[model samples]
Target: MTGTDTDAAALFASARERLVDAPRERLGDLQEGRRFLGIPRAARIVPRGTAWHLGVLLLTDDAVLATGDIVRSRAEVRRGFAAESQRRRAELAAAAARGGVPEGATVHLGWHPIDLSALDAASRPLALREGDALVRWSAAGGWMPLARYLDERVELLRHPPERA
Candidate 1:
């Protein structure tokens, strides 16, 4: 693999390891009560045709590497109206019923890698331009370098603040 490819792969691996190592409660917090990673703990969605394109900022390099999926809105709605809490679960189940993917799918069944740069406005906040470093955003932290963001998140996951 080329140097850039190797670096990107390493980045993905390290991030995955850190995420896996985080305490279940912390990971759960990050996932915000979601049942599957494929459902994205956080994401930006855009509607296109019959599907809603789903994306989450998982990692980054030259381009923002994301876990992406396409959910058929019709199918998901057909399953029944989901309250805000159960939306993701309903989408995942509906997607599975439709074979978990459309023909010529760019994203596979699992939350595989996808270039967020290829997406439209949804990618703006996470885009890594030429000669630019990667970053992530949170309401409290705003924009932070990707490496720093990962480290901080993992550290917080390992040591959460005690609740009152």
Candidate 2:
């Protein structure tokens, strides 16, 4: 890899390594726009027409850097990821049954809505430096497996939907 690539990878790894099981905040306990440092507790993949998106990818960067819904540690990150994934899986299925994920859209890591229908205009997707983009994310690394992270999360803004 190029020096820059190597450096970036190292930087990403260091950030991920720093994450450990620590105290975190729950989603409902969070404010609308308040900023705090925390981990990604769970993620909801809301499907628009052409892409899948996370209503919010709870973060775990640090209480000092940012905040929202918090996941305690790296383990919680994994657990939340899996749990959210399962939850969204069912949600997507139902949505598909009702309408369908656009003609070419596909769901990777998906989850059910933390709430079936609710829109708090004050609620903005949290942005944290992960992988190459600062988007609402819920993973240990900047980049994650398939639909878990990567371009999918970064491009979430491009998609639109009611809720996960």
Candidate 3:
């Protein structure tokens, strides 16, 4: 979701272009996507098979914020992070209680960060998140060390995706 000023304009243009010649029934949904993405006049949207659900793509100064059926603000993301963090901690505890993985390895969870310090250097994950799978961080830089994952994410949030 990081790019230059032109990327933002092009993305918005692509999104807006979808509006013209669209069916009347779909206009409302398209407008909703625009509103959700906080774009002025454009947003590329794909049907999620529901009136309120849509695949949205909107570009900002730094990155394209894409999501399926959800438009959220920074505060919302922070709350979600706190909740997910607590859930993951509990899950880790439960897993440990039931005999966790041995040294040099760890379980992978969609929202949890696995500790790689105890493992060998070669086995370390440069970064771990819902990305690529949910964030696609690997494409940005697989060379990044595991310790820098959080910092990378925080940086990615340089601009928060907003809702109308």
Measured by TM-score, the strongest candidate is: 1
Models 1 onward score TM values of 0.37, 0.21, 0.19
Report lDDT (Cα) of residue 91, candidate 1: 54
Candidates' C-alpha lDDT? 0.40, 0.31, 0.29
lDDT of 2 by residue, 1-164 (tens): 54433443444344334333322222222112223366432333333212112334423242111232212211111224357766544444333323323333343322222210221222223222332323333444342332244234334433424593
lDDT tens digits, residue span 39-157, model 3: 55322222212111112222222223332222211111122436876654444433322332332222222211222222223222322332211222433444433223333433333
- Model 1's number of clashes is 0
State the displacement of the C-alpha of residue 25, model 2, in Å, after optimal TM-score superposition.
14
Kindly report which residue stretches of model 2 are placed more than 4 angstroms away from their true locations once superposed.
22-90, 93-164
What lDDT tens digits, residue by residue, belong to model 1 across residues 1-164? 44443454465567656555443210001112344756644222222212111123533222233434333322445545548647765555344334323322333222334443242334533434352334446335455444565566556655666870
The candidates, ranked best first by lDDT, are: 1, 2, 3
RMSD of each: 12.8, 18.3, 20.5
Candidate with maximal lDDT: 1
Candidate 1 root-mean-square deviation in Å: 12.8
